[model samples]
Target: MPDAQTPQLAFHNVSFAFDETPVLRNVSFELSSGETLIVLGAAGSGKTVLLKTALGLLRPTQGRVVLFGADVTAGSEREWFDIRSRIGVLFQEGGLFDSLDVADNVAYPLRNQPLRQCPEEQVLPKVEESLKFVDLGHTLDKYPSELSGGMRRRVGIARAIVTQPELMLYDSPTAGLDPITANIIVALITKGRDVRNATTVMVTHRFQDGEILAGFRYDTAAGGLGLTPDHRGDTQTRFLVLREGEMVFLGTQAELEASQDSYVSKFVPHT
Candidate 1:
């Protein structure tokens, strides 16, 4: 078990580029166990790239990426595969395979990841429980094409959480969903954080996603989100804003809202 001092995830001066062009520049942040980081930015602002780099899906051009106190900046693919087994990721648009049914999709990580030795017999039951957590227990037999967009997103969440990873990364989880569906998804994300005490990094375009994360805690007894008392000021959640591949803001909701930077202010969502 990792000691309490180690951060669940950290990016140290990380930068990434695509050929001659840069997509992320000198971006750095750290998320401790059970802490939440909300990433916000306009289109093409490197939000997705940041998550991908942290997950080792993309190699950085400079600096180090650390997971569970280990440096993985230049880790080999085989090493990354083992490290990835301990982290869960929900890629943009659910990223589910249309060829696989819900159960199989959720079971993919368990069966494929080198560190997860989940026995074949235990896969289905674990998959079912994960789906149930996302309120889609009955959709096990369903295919990705059969479900609505929102339901598919939930399935993605189910798949991401099935391995009970210590770190979870969500990229544009509610990008195309309606407000109601989006709120439900964020609520489920909050529930996952509270129930599992997992470290979370969510990249989203919606400021409301960050608000809900900072203002509420999942109430297991009530089976839903409950307003966190004293949430207006102090909170465990923090927000980071990116501008043209650079981190322009990193602070709490209050600090982020108060930021006067023209680029940062654009994400505050004028109510």
Candidate 2:
């Protein structure tokens, strides 16, 4: 368990509704530094609303969202601007601008800062570094329209990590992609956790993705990324199962597999 100090993200008895429609009901969880929390649920399961609440984009009707130990549920938009800088979000879609090239899109966040704070020279190098990290360095000049869906998603990831945020939120990153391409995106996300040590909360219905992320470790010895056979007990990855706007199960991969809950068993993929 994480110490009693400060959690990177927390939701306490959070509930949200749209008019008479309840979306999230009494959802609560905490993400510590360098941990990855995989949220598994079907469509319309309130996953995206949870992400929005974490980012302070949406306020909960019942409970508050605490970010880095600070309750930002009641914060104004102006106050959220600074808080947002410390977090990164990858939308379900690529969310790239059609008019901008890859490099510019990656640099968009940095450019929003004061010119005196981020000079032109500093901006380009950072953009180049971020793109290189995602293996998209060669696509710097390519427009979103000119790239494939997988490539566009990679570009979106490059843009998200450009500022080196301490927290990352991904909404169905692997949805609607071929298995091979989805694996590539999963690899990139793992890199963020293993290399950058960024705390992450990902929403996905793919059981394979959750398993790969929780079971695999980056093998630096191969000079490339690959899965490790032995499951390290020290893994920081965890699974959170959401059903009907409520948490049904939260545990390690082994615990999840051992669970007798029919709903959880049905969702667990067969090896």
Superposition error at 261 for model 2 (Å): 1.7
Give a tens-digit lDDT track for model 2, residues 125-196.
999999988888898888999998888888889888888888999988999999999999988887877777
Residue-level lDDT tens digits of model 1 in 8-52? 899999988999899999998888888999999999999999999
lDDT of 2 at 11: 91
For residue 96, what is the lDDT in candidate 1?
99
Go through the candidates in order and give each one's C-alpha lDDT. 0.92, 0.84
Q: State in Å the error of residue 3, model 2.
A: 9.5
Instruction: Give me the runs in candidate 1 sitting further than 4 Å from their true place.
Output: 232-235
Whose lDDT is greatest here? 1
